[model samples]
Target: MDKHGAKIVSVFSCKGGVGKTTTVLNLAGIYSLMEKKVLIIDMDLNSGGIAVSLGVDATKSIFNVVDDMSNNRFNTISNYIANYNENIDVLAAPKDPRDAFKIDSKYIDLIISTAIYKYDVILIDTTHILSPITLKVLDKSDSTLFMITNDPVDLKNARSMIAIFEDTEKKNYKVVFNQSKDTGKDYFTLFDIKTIIKHNIDYTIDRSFYIKDIDKYVIDKEILTLNKHIRLIKKGDVTRLTKIAIALLDKKKNNTRSEVA
Candidate 1:
């Protein structure tokens, strides 16, 4: 979509433990601060945590909506999302893992389209696996954020995927290095990482963003960007994340209408 138009941004990673979900939540927090209505869709069907981490009790999930759509029982987007606050809602992943497999990837376009008009931005947290579902999410996304860490294996895998994006001329993707995940694991410098991956690091969350009590925040259902102490303690980090969110909002991209609908 064009700048400021309703758009979907997909956050995925080379692997599962790379802080992909955390980035999504923090971006949603930043968007809320900007007073933009946001929908956070947990597409990591097997073990998504956006709903649980945010403490939003979603009775109907993405799977339910997809199942309803597949059976011609789907109605409106209102029936699926769980309200986190006035500006934020969540379309959770399946509560049961098996339900994930039953969700048809074909309906992803319809799911996103049904809700795109109702929100200023949709942040989709997808599984690291490149399943059919993930492929469709990437296709529908206005931009994709690839989260990476300082791990050797993760960087290697990222290099491979980013190479493909480069070869295919996918300019709508960004590489966000999450140094906060394992603060002490900064074996490779930023220069080395860019050299290895052959892609510039679009954003970096430094070790300063790392929290020793991250579990406490999760337990208390705290969004780091929304927490006063975190905002104060990690002021630069918060500002950096806001920049990423703002970039996603400002980039005029993927304005073409839905082909599936």
Candidate 2:
């Protein structure tokens, strides 16, 4: 509710494979360099890639904590968190997809609440599906980055989802045009994509950010932004990501002050 408390950020997409998780981790890497304590909650329960992508061997996960809470076995939140670095901590999803269903949506708020005061930023990685857990995350988020691609199907789906968000008066979201998802999928011009979606593109990830060897980064357990070569070669991309992260957090701070005034 204030500047001292952790700012919740949800990185989401109306369709999958739009660089949502990449954005989350990149932002986390930037925050780490800024000396911010970041907690990334892998909410894509069924097929989450956060732990694996980072190559973190998570022995305990979000499910364990939720189960503990549900059955009165809960204690400190640290029991379930796996440290990714000095500044970044992760709450991984269940290893088994079936376990996704066992956790209650109500526990999402509880988990976040328990960890809220301990972090400077809380980033949630979610699936495209608007499950109860995702809905709860959206409701709790201070700001959200909604990623979209240049694909026709992605635009169509985004347009509909944007319409719903506008209808509900959800003002805490920004549309991120990630052209890097597929460098060759530039079927629509900037104007055409904006016209179709009927929303202003708050940020753009140039196709130049697309790396053919991105898989290698995952294989090597590297955060793109934190990689020295990435910082030198793709410096602009990292800078833009840093700007987006700062703007998202600052926007929430400014809005909070306005409301309190």
lDDT of 1 by residue, 1-261 (tens): 234446789998888888889889999999998899899999999998998999998679998998898789999989988988888899999999899999888888798888887889999999889888987887788888899999999999999988767665666778889989888897898899999999899888888898998999999988889999999989998998888888887646434322211
Worst 10 residues of 1 by lDDT: 252-261
Question: For model 2, how does the per-residue alpha-carbon lDDT over 1-261 read when each residue is reduced to its tens digit?
Answer: 345689989998889989989999999999999999999999999999999999886678888998899889999998899888999999999988899999888898799998998999999999999887887787788888899999898899999988877776677888999998798887999999999999999999998898889999999988999899999999988899899989977853433210100
TM-scores, one per candidate:
0.94, 0.95
The window of 10 residues in a row where model 2 has the poorest summed lDDT is: 252-261
lDDT of 2: 0.88
- How many backbone overlaps does candidate 2 show? 0
Candidate 1: residue 240 lDDT (0-100): 85
Pairs of residues clashing in candidate 2: none
- Model 2: CA > 4 A from native: 1-3, 251-261
The number of clashing residue pairs in each candidate reads: 1, 0
